[model samples]
Target: MSNLPEARASRNLHKTYEGGSSIVGVLQQYAHDAAPELLRESGVSFGLQNTLDGDPFTEATTPENRRASLLSLAPHTDEIQRFIPLYRHTIHPFVPLLVDIDEFELHVCEYLESRAAGDLRDGSKTLNQWLTGKGINTIAVILATLSCSSYFSDISITERSTTALKFVARAFQALQLANYMLRPSVEAVQTLLLLGNTLQNTGQSDGSWILLGTTIRLAQALGLHAANTKTRGANSRKKEALWSVIVWQDCFLSVCHGRPSGISKAQLKRLNFAAVTGPSLSYFEIMCRVGCLCVDLTEDVPTLKGSVDLVEAIDRCYSNALPHLQSLDKCRNLHQRLEFFALQINMSFTIAVVCRPAMKKLPPGSGEDHYHQFLTTRAKQSLFTTLRTFLAFQALSSMPLRNWSMLHSALTSMLLLSVWEETRHDPQSRDLQERLVGLLLAVSEESSSADTDSDGHPSYYTQWLSPRSIRTLIALQSAIRNTPPLTDHVSPTRSVETLLTTSEGASLHQTGLPVLDSQVPDQITALLGSSVAYDYDQFDWSTVDLSPFAFIDETVNMPFYDSSQSNGFI
Candidate 1:
């Protein structure tokens, strides 16, 4: 971390300023801080070339054709009008920007007013019509709308999932022509955030993570991260909000995706607190704290410290964060409560991620005393907590939240619980395992029940509840019930680690999910059907102690989608 470009440049610049106490020192620091973004996004000679493969909007040949293609994919004005506000009310709280509700409403009204004047096809024109109407107001209005559809669709809201897809494609089209990263727009920073968000939600987080770097870089170029004082107005409030959003999101996703956060802790201290007030803001601060821990482990582990010190570092950072993890009732409003729950899912999942590697006493290719049993216990504790918390969120949420991060956390817990049941031979473990699986199945059915067809059958999430995951849950229960309790008659020679390919393997062979028949990802099949031999004698780890979430994120476990088949309006 000390040898990274940002740190080194800052060190040299400070030396040039002779202990860095003068105005020249401050200016140099600012220049040093903003250098990464400029080099990354500006695409200067010798810098890394932009790599955005198969991005729909960027593939278009010419500007005219790009607009035409984008126009061809916009969603209905009515659907956008309906779901965007629901998203603002629901998902927005988790990623709150300094937005004026009244102003946004007016923008929607203007688009509606255009359609009310006369319908292009049936009742309203596509969003592209408004874009073509002129003025930059369209970008601001559309990006907010895009935020709704992108996120909602990802959570399997069938009603508008297709609509969100169209809007996302359109947004990137607008971004392409605007030269958004190098130049600026009226809402460039906000637009970049929403764009990355849409990609993240749609299981394209690699691209989303890449886009985040560009967004943070551009935000810095605009001086959006400067310290703020008491006397601030709406514009100042907006910048502060944007800057906060960049830092919180950059750090949060960096942890999940295993990347370096551009903003260091020292850089974090440079920005004053956001010029806003809300219970959501308070929870946002908590998330930032957890994110910093993630950044620490991502950079430090395996390189800066050995396994034992790594466990202690986890304790020092995350355990002391107990006070920050309060009940949802502490929040003032409904949005804050929801956002707080989302934070809980993130924290628990992150802990499981950080502590998982230490669980295996003798992981593949390790020294004699390779494992820490205490860290293994901590991993299981965090994982079960993750399951219960996600179930609680489902029971409480009126509608299934459409955030990708939240869903991945839920899925991570589900997979980990299944793995735990397969390996453990205890009665209490079996009982608790059955209950959790039942709860998850019920939660999935209920959450997906919201968007149904004429026959009252689910439409969207039906596809996400893959046969493999569903059967894995059911097989876990049966495997628990039918497998004989530890008895003298049963002389077991097989190791628990091999149970993955042996126990679940035989069951999966019987269940015959399409993955077995089709070209499903090897990662999932390898996980469920193959077993890596481990010396169970050396490690006192339970089934749940394994790090299933390590390989999974929003993308790995997410069901496949074909954006080209979208139900377009224009």
Candidate 2:
């Protein structure tokens, strides 16, 4: 279909504005002289017309005729110049009117499609030229109009009665034309950011990320980083500032895209690690992204290489940024950098533990074996140091709200650490296990104290113990149980019971663990196999209700109750 004739005609108006004359001044004069009569003819309130004088047409005119009249006049450069001043002053009041500009654009596009070729084509060229001659502010207004149109086309509101979608496309096209005409100006960056924000708001995260990526590159090319280089005190600092924003944008996009694991790979690759400032900021952003992605367990682990690589990159950043971090002058940014580095390190530890079992093993003495060993050891050490630092920092001051998630994450890491220790017979593993147990106890105590219930149960602590955490804790205890008998260590059964009763314990018996008389599903029973044994008679089943604990009952199609009243038997 041919574009709107009125819209094409309006293009001539844009050309007039682009002629470099005092368009705003001219528009204001025109509005003062002709607005009253125009208002009467358009069937709008004189006051509203006066208020809207010189302003661009928007969506809010009350009567259909008034709105159409305003839009029809919007493309006329001569009429626009006369009221430009009044329009500028009353722009805020006309914001609602702008909403339906998309409808007007559509009307024009449709009209141009049927109109005389000269009027259609000549009008667009004229508006283009006029707009080109105008100042950045004029350009912004034009672009904003176009953006409003695009927004309407992309979104739908069932609650409202209006036809604004058509104009939306035209508005965007107009804005695009303006953007091309004014290349390299800060306006271009603003336009890109606006488009990115629009795409983000509409749930087009990939599109947003792509636009943001382009903006970041352009911002860099234009030397936005150079302005802050002096305050950053190093070339590296400037790069860090630049990459930080890019990483943050990517992180937000990744989070919006259902926490896709490898979404940030392209963004991460663009980071300039050579710059001092860039490393810290880049690492900080990467850590935050990884942490967010980890919590979104819906994401496939196999698609998480981007997150894994991000962690590895953070380690490299830590190595490079640590020396600068030691100096008090750079300590502020350094601390933040380390904090996030530590976070990513912990994430890496968790990912390694989850992925290692499935990972392909290397041949004995092969370079791959050495590489794997190095990663495993580094991940473990990083997890420990990061947790210690994080805890110490928390103890010293009021930590940020987001850091609370880290505590839960640390507990999970401890579980992984125990698993690692069991797999490898390192003597220091015992010390690490002790530290992890202490940390878990402290965390549980803190949680319990903060939210004790009427029944004296630690609700917060219980709630925080998610199924994943429960499984990890059980695995850790089971690992301890499987350890060979030592000279002075207590029995595995006693130790396991003690751990289950500790502050970290909740629903231990209900979580398909090796509890007495608890019916287990075939899958779980298969998992248990002949490795674990259950003594049904060891527990006084008469004293407790085991109905809710039953997974499957063999004798009957339903669960058997112990017929106890005191234990709140289900």
Candidate 3:
């Protein structure tokens, strides 16, 4: 046995040993027993044993079997330190052996030495080979690794300083190459999404966006966007794969700072209702883009309108998208996407309202007047109606408390916009005032009907009312009511006083059935009275509060909407 080389000896032992145990089983047993002893004897000096008395078993044969055997033995506390170099050196010559080892082991080996980084590239090539020859564990492993790295970057990057973005970029390129070399796999597209998300989180958004954009192009190239196919046949599978690619691409584009290239009108046309699984995901992407564009209040009206048009385009493509916003189907996922859409619409409406004064001044071109007027009215009314519907839906549906906060912030912002719009036109002001009264009444009714806690107080609105929303509402109201009068550049003291009186009086009388939070009404009054202007160090909220309604003044002191304090909505 010693005269025969190690490979031939192992082969002979396997052929000769005819017990109940298989060759694999016996090898496993031997490796288990020997690995610990080998480690103990070698101590700190063991660096990857490459030749096991060299009859030279195929590189593929020993690494997997030996690695398994070593694992079974559960060597010393320093098992990793001992096995890293050994596994690395042993697997070096065998391309197939690289594919057999698991990703975690690969990661461990890479962590042990920077030089081991080449193993991943080697492993990827091996996987490509395995996928091409006979579809087996390699494809699965590749998909799993991609997903594991994408969703759980902290785990994947445990020992590496590599950013999740760069890792995802590498994974995308690998998957793309694999697709070119092997059969198209849904697993590959899904892995791309995982990589996209990881890249987004790691601030390599540009790289991720470009990768996703390329994926969309690839899908289109493969005829994956064929609209007439929806079943599990070859055409349908291809289409489904392509749809996922497009959705992920859109998401990446929507979230990243700069727009990705390659998405043309033709591509957008392909993504109409017929090609998508549901409009929710695509709508969400459009909403994200809209949000990013409209966050800055000072952006040009045309720019804001461009954002609005993008959302409208989505709405046109997926007509059912808006109606599904309040539908109680798949509540959690539906609510999340709907909430984002709702916020985008509300912000767009605010933009329209802010731009209304400018709209009136634009010189009338042939059809521009009608178009501009329609946009102004339609955008505001649609936003208001949608917001009201959302609130009503929340009141009826057993949504989580966080939903309430979202609804509240939306309502607050809508109210502010309506009031601002009214202030712009006297006739519209009365109509808005009436609507505000009715909304307040509905809120009051809902709050009263809701179950109170042990302390007899309703749940706090913190879960929904993000700080930014609160600040936006305050600033919006401030802007509308305090706008310098057209007659003279007078201080906004009178306007502020009028707003304070009207709001306080409306709350006191429970006008139009307002949603009366006893705390909120008081807080609004106090904030109006106490908040001072930066220019004058004087307390503006003080003079505003010295009314006959002192009780109302004392109660309403806190900031109404926390999010209002920021640079408006985003």
Best by lDDT: 1
Clashes of each: 0, 56, 36
Q: Encode model 1's per-residue lDDT on 1-570: one tens digit a residue.
A: 111122123221111101245443344467776675443333333332333312344553653554555445444576665567665666665655434556555666665565556532332334334333122224444654665545454444564555555666666656554445544433666767776776666556678789888877777656566654655888777666567677777866776666678776665776564333333335555555445445565464452125446546544444433233456555676555666566677767776766655543345554434345555666677777776677667676733334667766665555555444333444444444445555545555565667676866445434454333444445433333334334423334343334444554565455442112222223232323343332333322333243444434322434343222334100
**Whose TM-score is greatest here?**
1
- RMSD from true fold, candidate 3: 19.8
User: CA lDDT of each candidate?
Assistant: 0.52, 0.37, 0.37
List model 2 lDDT by residue over 410-446, tens digit each: 5434444443432333445444445544454455445
- Return whichever of 1 and 3 wins on TM-score: 1
The C-alpha TM-scores of every prediction are 0.61, 0.36, 0.36
lDDT of 3: 0.37
TM-score of 2: 0.36
Runs in model 1 deviating more than 4 A are: 1-76, 97-103, 110-134, 140-147, 150-159, 225-233, 262-266, 274-281, 302-325, 328-340, 354-380, 398-401, 416-465, 469-502, 505-570
